[model samples]
Target chain A: MKENYYQPEIECASVETLKALQDERLVKQVKHVYENVPYYRDLMDKKGVKPEDIKSTADLHKLPFITKADLRDAYPYGLLAKPLDECVRIQSTSGTTGRRVVAFYTQHDVDLWEDCCARAIMAVGGTKEDVCQVSYGYGLFTGGPGLNGGSHKVGCLTLPMSSGNTERQLQFMTDLGATILCCTPSYAAYLGESLHEKGYTPETIPLKAGIFGAEPWTEEMRRDIEKSLGIKAYDIYGLTEISGPGVSFECSEQSGMHINEDHFIAEIINPETGEVLPEGEVGELVFTSLTKEAFPLLRYRTRDLCVLKREKCSCGRTLIKMSKPLGRSDDMMIIRGVNVFPSQIEAVLLNEGYTPNYRIEVDRVNNTDTFDVYVELSPEMFSDTVREITDRENKLAAAMRTMLGIGPKMHLVAPKTIARSEGKAVRVVDKRKLH
Target chain B: MSVKQISVFIENQPGKLAEATRYIAGHGINLRAMSIADTKDFGILRVICDDPEQSAEVLREGGYITNVTEVLAVGINDAPGSLATILEIIAKAGVSVEYTYAFLGTRMEGAFMIFRVDDNAKAAAALEAAGIKTVEQSDMF
Candidate 1:
């Protein structure tokens, strides 16, 4: 615990101390948003809530909840809690589904965010002696900047590789003896394959640990990447709206990520009702940025589906832990009175010896939702007879039915027909939305 | 003896069979005989071709999913009930025939039938013992 934890005082803080800190920060943040941001102020007034109404974290439910739709409607400066001159930087999400989410940060907010990231790096055994390579794309993307700042705070010699350039990436990784690799899991998998093709085994890989996130990856993939890259891959969770990639991180226990609850208060709520669920119940994740000064959000609905539990960890940190997000609520589709997530289909596909890359096409005809998934036929799983191939397709569909509680029509197409995911793969094509 | 046959996976759409066969032909591989076993949405284009291993590899490089299977190449009388007789022998051997197609490139006079059975060794032995001529991989080329 001495070398593992970065801020033992805050990380290992007692429940009472953590609650008092959250109650204080939540009160201050509500007041700050109510006084400065008119959008949230208007929301509060509509809800008949005032800054005085929220006295502590217990009163957090009294405040109006903000959603992604609200953020988009607020657009540029509508959600700002501070003046433009005082703000230091603004990071934006790719915003593939909706309008870009631009999060503002003051110098103090940046420092606190970096501190959160530093705690993550240290949780994965990152140190000043380690050469940390940040391969997550920089610019508007928060991954590169977040990990880079954290590496600096930890005093590691930072390599801001900023994604792509595989040849040079391998060169620098081997030559510089980089110990920590920070990137998306897909990129890490690609790098591991490239390294193998270039005659470098997992034993020859210089990285001892990896901080992989910004996308969902299965535990099996994590073990595979760990074996291939010769590193203990760690999961780091964050969103651009909630101060980027250090909002929560995995400790040595590896059960679930310990959310930096001191800075960002994480909660689970039912997506349909907005009722707060009890701890350990899976629901949509709601984050209230308690310490974000420039863009302080109050009970912001993240729409990320997960579970949070505050169990006593062997790592000795009392921060409440959040399970790796099951799937985003936005990615869910209802068919024949049954809800199916594309991630569920993906899990079934992987379990059946197929690649996770698939296209889920959903259409509604005559008031019935038609669900179809196009899974690519890899060379390794090919068979000569139509019965043999059709048997596989039937088995996959049955597994998906068992997993999702709804059966989807399975199409086994030739490989290279489906588009591969580079960063975030668009897996769903919903025709119902079009109509 | 069993002959190597390459099967290419093709979606049941326009020009899929042409696309797969063209890929192998473009790689200078000559096709001997082929059959399409199709379902509602997809089909397997099974082919007896020159250089079966090389043809499958070429199709794979062209991004077509291919599988190689060893099938019995038995030469039978080019008359009525020839296929029935061979299948009866296979059934007597307690071997189930999965699929069968004609081998058009047989250099002899009799009709050559390709048989993919549950147990190739048992079926091949029974057919050969019943005076059916079993072709080898070199016999076609």
Candidate 2:
């Protein structure tokens, strides 16, 4: 029997109905932004668009695209649609880049955001009977608070165990028989390793499903974590700029994550030209928050490169699906005139039977690109002699060259030399700036 | 017989060796013999210590990647051609050495050479067949 899940009315809406909802929300949100947020209104006016010009989703292209730079310039409250008294909370980006993005949420906006997150939890087979442990970091970062609210919405026993304190995380997880795990994929992988170190097998853990996101992780990592934890690992994709991590989530199908069309309208556009691409064409993912109150981002460039699919999902949700992001256009590195992404390097390492704990160091020495990859040797490979280890490194370099069209100097480091993270793992270190 | 050799990976940076030695010394471990094999990026500090397990544990607690390998320790007279004699015997037996390091023995007339051979058992057989005196872990400590 098909199990009844949460938020069926919106999730299982037909295409016509979903489009109608998007059109209604898009029209209202456009007018809301145009009237209230002068920063976005100026951009719209510059683009020769008025609030009346955007009557439906069909006129979405008429508005100007908002990039992270625009958001950075706007900073706090520049893009806020609602008044400051109406806002309830704020979540900011890690500011790893130039400037941090602060997104505001009114109580209503938080309710809708949590509703989207509840849909994500339900997609992963979450219910009130299950114990849901949210391990994503809380405060400022959208990961923890977003999922925590969603878990509450699902009426599950929620453990707001923010990131860190692994020992306590495991203790509560085991003692409470937590059935659902949520956090960054890297943290999930770390927990898997820790569990093994503590001599606990997958069967000993009560977790049945994991909702992993907040960073771009490869499918190879998904399989590794699944094997380690004995749980179906689901990918949840969202950005703080777009209201944290409930924009989309993978269902039992696991092929792609179904975007909550009622709230978010996703589009793919050519990264270089800014021209919107048709469905199935891989390009930069752009999202327009349809129903956000405080910050209503329209045609916001996400910088993530992925494709979209409208194929019938077996799970019975008519929501459109977005493929796992291939990589971020902003994070793409051009080494020796060739485009390279850390995800590509990660895929190569995992394929060659190496753990995903590898670091890529790129530097310009004497006007030449010096690319070096330091990979942690697995236990089986650790026993190899220096010559044998060098041979393996050469083989890896050859494999990377075949895959990436350019060879990287591979160095085999001892296991665990590379730093692991409780959040996003730092995979690439570009030393060109120091030079 | 094979001697336990604890190898620690140290970055090729200033004071790394000193830091590792300080940690080991703080644990009250004494190195009986030691050698450093270095590359441009990093170095492997291999040592035969009074307590191999305890020394490795101490270095690991100091955040070093330490591995214990079974290495053959052979005694050779401190004279010209003494090292070559053992190498010739092992080569004649079709055994290959991965790496070798030596230090003055805890005696007057000879030095102790550590052999990391491709096959520890095969190397031990070759040395025994040639009537060479091999040092065991107990003998070294």
Whole-structure CA lDDT of model 2: 0.84
**Tens-place lDDT digits, model 2, residues B61-127:** 7767778899999988878998999999888878888899888876435778999987888878888
Worst 10-residue lDDT window, candidate 2 chain A:
A92-101
| Candidate 2 clash pair list | none
Cα distance off (Å), candidate 2, residue A138? 0.7
Model 1, DockQ value? 0.60
The docking category that best describes candidate 2 is incorrect
TM-score of chain A of 2: 0.77
Question: What's the TM-score of each model vs. the native?
Answer: 0.62, 0.62
Error of 1 at A292 (Å): 0.6
Worst 10 residues of 1 chain A by lDDT: A92-101
**Which residue pairs show collisions in model 1?**
none
Where does model 2 exceed 4 Å of error? A96-98, A332-435, B1-141
TM-score of chain B of each: 0.94, 0.94
Cα error, residue A76 of model 1, in Å, equals 0.9
